[model samples]
Target: MPRARPPPPPPRRMEAPPLPGFSEEQFRAACRELDQPAPAAGGPWQLLVESMGVRIYRLYDEQSGLYEYKIFGGLADCPPKLCADVYMDLDFRKQWDQYVKELHEKIYDGEKVIYWEVKYPFPLSNRDYVYIRECREMDVDGRKIWVVLAQSVSVPQCPEKPGIVRVKNYKQSLAIESDGKTGSKVYMYYFDNPGGMIPSWLVNWAAKSGVPTFLKDMQKACCNYSKNT
Candidate 1:
């Protein structure tokens, strides 16, 4: 008798059905927020921490009862284009960002969508997000800038998993440009409501510690990107 055929490889995960299209108008509106100036001190924006040349601020959202964060800084020794590329590289992100449990992009109806699951500490359920994102290059007064925008989106195809909390309210914007040297000038705004009973103190602590840590990790990743890719 012929030797038993080798077992078939595991089937690939099925791609979700077509998602709703994110419009150019929506994308442009989001980009405008990234272009706006940072909120001045002594306003609703309260400064959280300033370290390593990065300033982080938080503003309370009355409607959501959550905090939104803004960051202004530069990534030293990392060029603008390289910095942006490293940020948008999802495959590489999985390798560097320890919090990223799962991240990938899928195209549906000619639009690309991102799915991400983040690992939370023990006893806390993981949080997952499905969002639409776009990136653009712009020239303002002869200065080149890169802008990336993302917001949560709902679709029937990506239903919430049982053990994970679905984050329905989330938005992120980033603008990067040359720092007049070999570094990148960066501005970032982020907000997300991880749907659960998580305490406010824990959330605030995570943001305060997490943002700086993430930027440092990204900077290190950027330094190694060319070799890795």
Candidate 2:
């Protein structure tokens, strides 16, 4: 597990404007994009992982350090609601979200600011992200869906700590649609530029390896969630 820094003086969640003024439209736009599914085939995306009932894709270039990933899969014995609950349980997240070393949050002004640091393997500087998380559910053509959105944010109350690189452009979302049975379909998106320099090989493997592992870990946690609770 990582470390959790002390809570700061109460500050609004995403309202403190990390860059400039962030509007509600931008937030809704992100949600819409994540909810839209990627085309069945043909695109810049390269299939990386196709095991454990999950498929992960990546789009990147040798010259560009920025990386983007689209991960989709079905949990053999997990429901969408259980999966969403586990993902939202910030406390349990630190346990199953292997890369996370520290997780904390400050709530104010009707917004939630999540502060977390992720450990990168040796020689790579540990990366951190401060994202605003929002969850919404709606009925689409009579079927219900749940979406959770998170994007990197900067707040005066939460300053960059020493010894870690801040992921200033991290944006991610998790979308799940229940099938009215015991199963659900999930779509996850991630894009970010880890500050400073990192090897392209490291980036490739993180998408191919890191993401698949995280998905399986999430499913396992869901299986025994009741026991733990």
Candidate 3:
């Protein structure tokens, strides 16, 4: 009798979602808009919040250009793609290796959208708040206008390590396209103080200290150089 063939080796797994900010639909849409085919559809495409050890509810909104993702309640490691200066869909393990390396050297360069996870211990009797700032250039009538920006506190409802400590007194602002008459809109995401459990400290202190401010200045300097040269 002839030997039976093996069962096709169970199809290969798909890639994980881009990042927390990118949902299935939004990612799909963005890929489609760029004339790129969507990543394969399968069981492994979803992200496993190692801390929570569960899959998150991912939602998408093409109209406002946003993707809403919900997780448990703790600090989740930064998604490799989101934390990278460049964006590419690659193996999580591979991307994570680079993430840790860049983080250690404090030379991680982020692309268009910067997603950072800042942590500080709770019960801050003597400490400063963590802030997130975006370096952006304003354009008016197709011409570069002014370089204006600001920094604000951001509170992330991390999933995984819950009940111990959470981000409180969160104040985050996003630059939104406002009606031409109203100039531009700056939206805010704020919350009350958080529970004091973890010490008011940081996980990557050297990496973030004054980095955002430095980046903002760097952008302005580049624009000035371009104009002169």
Candidate 4:
């Protein structure tokens, strides 16, 4: 008989935080990027659209052939808590998040580390990310808001898995604000070098079709959480 595998060890804390405030800085930068005007001189970013109240933007990185994208979630009926819970509940998230092929959480270096695999079209390699995430509540402009941020972290304990292309660098920020009733303001940013021979058409599709679909799905799930949970 084969030997049974032992349980994984518990997470450990670092003597000092690494890349302190990296996520916050990234989040701030994302906020600024969102307000900036679209380039007129024909730089990388050349696409913008608004559909179903969601403003979508895309940027093509000549250095990497990868595009950085952002989606502004217009006010939905989802409460801040419910909207935030859509992604926090990893177990339930996989069921509704159509883009995620696999996702699970593990503690590493005293932080919530997530293992995520994103589905890709056939003939293209799937993308994976190991990121440290944190959720915090803060007062923003005299109103309470919840901010959840995650960014790829390089750690020896979390190595790139086989059969998945690891995203060397990626940053995501989600800010949720409630109006004390049942309305929320949501914002998201995603940038990654998927590290594969992904064509321009696929990249375009991701910004044009993929982002809005994902956000709409999340909104629908949030609206249904009360019934399910």
Please report the candidate that would top lDDT against the real structure.
1
Write the candidate numbers in order of decreasing lDDT: 1, 2, 4, 3
Q: Which 10-residue span in candidate 2 carries the lowest summed lDDT?
A: 18-27
Over the stretch 36-112, how does candidate 4's per-residue lDDT look in tens digits? 43444476555577777777767767787666776766556887767777768888787787778988888766666
The estimated TM-scores of all candidates read: 0.85, 0.80, 0.24, 0.78
Give lDDT tens digits, candidate 2, residues 12-78. 6555543433455544544454354453578788777776777787777455556578887766678
Order the candidate numbers by TM-score, best to worst: 1, 2, 4, 3
Off by over 4 Å in 3: 20-135, 141-229
Model 3: worst 10 consecutive residues (lDDT sum): 99-108
- Return the number of clashes found in candidate 3: 14
Q: Model 3 Cα RMSD, Å?
A: 17.7
Cα lDDT computed for each candidate against the true fold:
0.83, 0.75, 0.28, 0.73
- Whichever of 3 and 4 has more TM-score, that candidate is 4
lDDT of 3 by residue, 1-229 (tens): 9999878887786643332232334222222221211223453223322222212322344553333332212112322112221112122323332222111111122213222333333433222233333333334445322221223233332232433333323333222222233232212122223434323234123122322332333223333332433
Return the top candidate by TM-score.
1
